[model samples]
Target: MKIFELPQTNPLSANRTIPNVDSRGFHYKDFETMKPEDSKLGDAGFYVGIKATCVYHSQTERIALHFLDFNTRVLTMRTHYPYYEEERFAKKYLSKAPIWRKEVATIDIDILYENDDFELAQHGVSCKDKEEEFLTQKVVRRSARDHEFYAGINGTWEPVVKNYFARKEYDNYEFILKHIRKSNVLALNEEALIVSQLWKKRGLKRPMDSLLEPFARKIGTDKHHLFRLTCVAIFLGHLRLDHKYEFNLRTPLRLRPDGVYQFSRGVETAPWGF
Candidate 1:
């Protein structure tokens, strides 16, 4: 399913207004009380924002739902197990919050697992081709407006976690998983052997200028080498190297930087099991 439909919204009619305070407390007025002309959708004279967030696991195609009412600041995040009873998964991942702010929204959503197979077969597949179909699905109809608003925001949570990962020092699979869970970026195996291998060999202390010559030689005549090098640099940066020499060993030979290199003092212990 497309990422955009994960969150869906519907405009409210204009005639709607804040429910009058009564002996019980404040509550929304009934839709029946409003006039037909005033009740037209999108005419809710005042702002009443709603949003829904759904994270889709690329590998398993599972989805987790996070509902938000921008107007009231209420949140209801839950998971539905398609293959099993909804309550089964609900007890584990479902969260109920009356309010959530943008600053902490990413953290809240990150904790929900989007790869639950049972959950995917039930909710994920229903919206596989038409994400907006959830709007009509009774399970999500009550929060359609909220979901739409969330769709409008469009996967902002992933980038936030990725940014955090980009700033940290790379350690092991656990460290990567911490950010990966939050960002939903990389889908490496649990062991992340490739990353571990690169991490182990990344401690060599060669001069940058010397390394550049060999890299340039290996990259000779390949137009795509530049693009590959750029990707390598980004991945290396996420690994958090203090010096350029540390990157040379981890980077593929053809993609190494081809320019002057400066060496810094003080060697840090590498974490890879070589």
Candidate 2:
């Protein structure tokens, strides 16, 4: 099934406001209402915000419910967490506040997931492909507003974990069933998110110099070599992880100030078994 994204703002009604951390959000005081036994110490309980009714269209129409649980005190465009069983969440939290109950809304899953222009609509872009307007004023690029992460490029673990177990099935699925899967498809993966934030804050850019030029003759002109070296430098600059790593080879890699990677002879070769 394709990923479903709930509209951040309430498009159902004009007067409704989206419940976020800053607005009608779950508060630390609200957690006090839950019985101490039901709540754990030092555990930051979740916030149930925007709710949507998802209807699956097929031979037999199926209906499902989903909620966005924005963690307490976290503030970001992608702060909402996906949760199912809206009744369970309501029974636990919404009984106390009547006004907050207004945040819940209904939606069609097919309109959001299967539509061709859903990507453009979700970002609030207002432009039509008009042939008459050649010199139309460009207010902003759609790419700037679109930050949703897909699989593979952003180090998202959902697809990775899914692929690992998908190859084989066992009578005992218990090995993989116990883990809680928090759906985080709305935002970039943790690594890319951090990098993007750092890039904006620090004005970071990939240096366009090659340190592997000296070894280029030996290694030849493989693009992967340059990409690998660039990634190493990027990790060092953005992640604050400068620890030395040993590859399963005789050469030792080092980073140069120009953001290029250099390799030198190691003092000792790896053991044959290694």
Best candidate according to TM-score: 1
CA shift of 90, model 2, Å = 4.0
Error (Å) of candidate 1 at residue 116 is 13
Any runs in candidate 2 off by more than 4 Å, and if so which? 1-79, 82-88, 92-210, 218-224, 236-274
Q: Which ten residues in a row have the lowest lDDT in candidate 2?
A: 155-164
Q: Whose lDDT is greatest here? A: 1
lDDT of 2 by residue, 42-135 (tens): 3223322222221122101111111111111111122122212356657757577443432432111111111233221111111112223223
User: What is the C-alpha local distance difference test score of candidate 1?
Assistant: 0.26
Off by over 4 Å in 1: 1-203, 221-274
Query: Taking the tens digit of each residue's C-alpha lDDT, what string does model 1 give over 100-158?
Result: 22211111121111221312110112222233433457536434433443344332222
Question: What is the C-alpha RMSD, rounded to one decimal, of candidate 2?
Answer: 20.5
Compute the lDDT for candidate 2.
0.24
